[model samples]
Target: MTLKPARGLAVLLCVLSPLAFAQADAVRKPDPNTRVPQGVIHHAATGFPDRIVASPLQAGDAGFAVSWRTSPAVDAPMLEIVVAGDSPDMGTPRQVSSRTQALQTENGDARYHHAVIDGLQADTLYAWRVQGDRTWSAWYHTRTAPAAGAPLTLLYFGDTQNQNTSLTTRVIREAMRHAPDARLALYAGDLVSGGDGEDDNEWAEWFEANDPLTTSMVVAPAPGNHEYFEEFEDTPMERRVLGAHWPLQFALPANGVDEAKETTYWFDYQDVRVAVIDGTSALDLGTAEAQARWLDGVLSGNPRRWSIVLTHQPFHSPRAGRDNVLMREHLLPVIKRHGVDLVLQGHDHTYARRGADAAPTPVFVVSVVGAKQYRLSEQARATMRPVGEDTQLFQVLRFDGGRMRYEARTATGRLYDAFELIDEADGKRLVEVTEGRIDERRCDREATLKGRKDRCWE
Candidate 1:
């Protein structure tokens, strides 16, 4: 089967056109006086379908959702689908009209369309595309979750925020190269550093970086702090709100807390139940208790064999003088009572992994995929074994009958860290897969008193 790069033509036109550049300049020319000015709209929406992404459904069901963008909110777009076939036509396809929403940005106006398909047979692969703007997107493959107790693979990324199209893009593609059949791409927030009005280009870079992968695998994203900004900035009534592009870019499950619908949601695939918590909204924007209540109800009644928590902030703070204490106070108890197996987090640009303390304890992980890196603190190093600093990495996790295997690889796809969580009779036991791992990468320490410091130290 040909792996056509879906919407490649439209993305190129959006990224490289001179007219798009002129429009970007007209919309948001950065102020030279400001420290970090707004960026131009490099990946403006063309008349064609672009930024196509597939997301997962909730309730442990076997289906997926597709979303895409058009320049001026076309109401006639259709999300066409069929069981994936050998030829390009994808056999005889069935169609459903996409629900459309008008989205306005500083760059201009565009249309966002989404469609949800569920109740299909399990362990099935399907081909789908969006038709609008007098053109059809390239056919792409998406799959339902494998049968229960089957081997399921997923890719987890932390903060693909800055320099995504250039630097973070490779790691993402490398992940697909390593595990091409990965069922989903799960993000622990900060997928793009800019959801603010002036940062539309960053979202474009993100779409371009994910590219073909975004169209294929189901995307499960939680909102990080960067996904929000003040509505009326520098004003008396300014209030922090989720990004406008968020709802338009991805259509996630609305089964979370009523106030923070898609941002705080839960879904199940095979044996694992994944809960996406909006720590940014919970702690920063006064929805902590509501999400906590929702989280408690969801996790307490979770029907899956295992539960994994995906969120922006960590329960255990790694950096000194930085703790999400309020969020932890509200949500950690529920996590413990419910015995969530793994907690995936981002926002610490450094990578740190902390194993469970005892039986039913959750294993915590924080990683970064962006080019930007930070120093791993001494406390983090002490608490979290196998910590890393100034490194960019992506992780591929696989779950089989009784074991969950995780491998963290570099941009070049070399094995840097590995682990296994074995489901025992009592609880899941943590096992570090250490044989093939390369030496732990870290900045050198100062030994001689006047010696030139390593670049990371500086």
Candidate 2:
């Protein structure tokens, strides 16, 4: 097929080339096994397919969901899938058509396409590619979520809003270095700096920065406050509404409240139930009550072995004068009653993780991986433990049945913290595995000694 890149590793290397050059000002030795094929577009642009992402469906879903974008929409965007080891160009690869959603942004009109690929065997590896502008993208490898007994791992990030292209790519690359075969890339929120209307450039940068990973790892993004844009601006009363790019950019399962469609949705990926809440819409808009009700139902009787809540703003705010009280009041009860395992969140511009040794409450994690940095407020310094400031971070988690191993790492691939949780027959036990982790990351005396341009902390 015209789309086939020999092993798909060359395109991956090509995508990471910019970051690699940024690191060493030189090209690293290419892998002897990789080959660059023709028709590979190295950067995101009009008429070329970019910003591709995959997401989960039902628990043990036989298939998965993928979304991509292009300018000048193709007449019929298609998906081609083949068994991992099979010749990609040989037999007729299973074909599926995509539904296109056209979006007009500051840059121009871009077409977003969504496709559902199903009827595949469970726990099987597949390489797939998308057709855009009559051109096919590089092959990306993804596997069907394994049945209940299979192993699963996920890479989680807090935010990649500011400096997404340069700095954020470092953390994402480091994350992939640690968990190359991770099944899911979970974002706590603020995936982009949508403080203004959706900037196609930002989305393009986001996808490019993590392109190699997104096409394979698949993303489950939560909506942070930054995801909401001021709609109807210049009116008597301008209101912030959820950015249109969200629902169009991602074809999430429509299992959330009617008020919060793609933003507040949940799905089962292997043995984990991933519930993403739109705290931005809930607190700023009017979806609190509806979402709260829907979340209760979603989590109350969930049958998955593990349940994780992905929200933008964290309830237990480590920063002083910041608390998502409305969200906590509405959703914490449901989480507690359901015995949710982990709550991954972002938007605080810092890192803080709070866990309970004896209590059954969920372990709440607030982290940020972007260039933006914030100091630990007095509330955090006085209360929360395992706090990190002035450092970009990422988390990789491994799940084998009822036990989970978690690691939090820095932008340069240093282990910052490590922990594990085991859901025993009696109850859940939390263990801190901090042997190899570096000391807690905090600003130094120079930070406080520096001027405003490099002020240490807020």
Candidate 3:
């Protein structure tokens, strides 16, 4: 049997004639900027008000693959891509093209609709919206990555799992304010607070917090353990939503195999190659075979100037239940072999920076942006090297043609950590950062619940 490209992989182009174009100029055009107009429209196989999101628009790739949600979802939903080119003046933007097709929707409690807009020109700006039946979303726009060898800037955030709207929002907005020209946003996962098992309100909060940032920020998120449902054994309903939320929210790369296809994949931005992995899948469920194999292949295939690995579990972490020995055993070896420059993770609910344990110091960092806080123990503080607490943080990473620089800061703009990774012929050189003094105060004083710590950081 022959394997087929995933439903959203098709590219449709039309060869237009000169005389036909002249005659078509007589037809009337509709306004594309109109709001979806609040009205009940028949749910297209792929149309609903999902937590609409876009991932990094790689160099030479088409428009972003937008994923959204709808109930009673089918395997396929028709998606429409309307492209609007950039403009120099502040007047109306120019329309480039538009097309529609049937794409697949991964279904469950939160059904997912995904489609890739192909044939986009590199380094050009474009606007698009996904629709089903009569329902259409506000057009969103993203600029494709500049061609290879171009300088780039990307933002990285750890965990946004607690009190998302109130806490994480301030930190995220501040990060964007510091560096407004970032190309892509890399989230280490736990993008939501579904760990408590209450789905409806929790997801809404996550969306509310991220919506403002995502307007222009192309996000790529890995799954943290908090993304998992609390009840594992009983409800099939819960199992259905296990990994469904991710696909419905963000349109990621589909080149990986099996579970890694959309959940764990690699893509190129400018001169850098980024690999996103699922620590939850590999560590919790023991499906490391495909990710490991895919990771190796991705490294072997990469010729980019810089390579980075992203996940939710850190090999060097200060939080409890964070050390995923399985990931270290299977995945870290590949990263080391590939000479990856950076590894970003979150699960500790704090920020930390560590020196390279393996040969080349692959600068490893962990951070959090939620209301949920934890204390770093003596062992954790000692082992993790640089530690932070009772603070919400975000990272701004810049990759120029020559050097890579990163800064960790709090929502109030207090500098926590800062460093530069100098690129060399053999490998990258790490520069130690000295910023704010490590806050050693413990937050868990009075017991809150039976199982976990009580006072966060008073």
Candidate 4:
């Protein structure tokens, strides 16, 4: 498959090379050592649901969607939810029917089940569990989104594709610890390194990294290029396909373009509306116009006070020679017209916060939370100052009535950058709040040498 080069960037099409294709195929192969031993009597053995996650199906959290995995033995799966009380016992559990699918995985065959619990009370704490055959998972508690005008904080992560089980795990745990009250965790795509998205061990490690968090906090994810895979018959790759596990693993809203249904959707939390787009499909396939049309409608009908867009590729590339010109040309106009407050992105391994130069509509930010590091490009330095090269970082964003505060922290919980966006009657203002923060991390010779020793400065 040959992708048309984005404007002024011929290297973007190099991803179709045989070497890159081979490397992608190799990365998707499951590691034998990481696979679960056959006949092991684990939680997945008795149909105990795992990888449990919750998402909003409607605005104001009137409805919630949940998905999980169970053993093959448990064909008929169900979800039981109840309003939590002081006691350990759930009183009068409301049972919801679930749709189940049989999936053939590298480890073995398993059933993925999903159910949407609707008519949930706003701001109410509910305890829920999944039942398969005679086994049931432990009850987990989750709070629905509060009414509009409620203040909330959210955790954002970028490109946790490498070292997902080890380094990524630590970063997520630390971010969660720092913001325990975070209502939702948003991943800017590339959740795993597997290009085909079928590597069982890589998926396992990713789930393990999120262990108990998925059961409680809501997860909003986008698909990166790595989340897609291409299959070849003889020599050259033929068609690009989404990861096999994507649809089965995530139960997102279906309010998106037909080409990218669940992968591209929008949801409203409090006063903010978040629209997720499929950048990979837009760039590789011919779905840019379709997504752009859908995005225009979504933005035009927006009733929320603040609107945000999340995508795998940045509208403005942080690297010198790399830029998603097609994405910018197709989607940036819609974002600007809608007066989006923020645009969160990943796929660039460096850290950059742009749009501070008198941009009133949206603030663009690119960040990373995994070990993969890239040097800041000359274009990035010229366009986006206060950039972090060879750094692993995460962002915590808080949303109030008319103010949004953002803080970027390193792996060790050090403050790297800070800013706030205040919306006034005139327009939005970006306030630099990085007082007493450390200086920007540049890729100097000493840091490059240390990076070779696995000690890159954050």
TM per prediction: 0.86, 0.86, 0.76, 0.86
TM-score of 3: 0.76
Candidate with more favorable, higher lDDT: 2 or 4: 4
Tens digit of per-residue lDDT, candidate 4, span 293-385 = 999999897888888899999888886667787888888888887888889999888899888345755889899987667767778888885
lDDT of 2: 0.79
User: Candidate 3 residues 141-251, lDDT tens each?
Assistant: 677777777778888988887667667778878888898888688899888766443344455557667775664656778877766754555766334225445555676
lDDT of 3: 0.67
Error of 4 at 211 (Å): 2.4
Mind giving the per-residue lDDT tens digits that candidate 1 earns over 351-382? 78886666535888898888656666778978
- Which candidate do you rate higher for lDDT, 2 or 3? 2
Instruction: In model 2, state the lDDT of residue 175.
Output: 90
Residue lDDT tens for model 2, 27-60: 3332211121233333334667888898777544
Q: State which candidate, 3 or 4, has the greater TM-score.
A: 4
lDDT of each: 0.79, 0.79, 0.67, 0.80
CA lDDT for candidate 4: 0.80
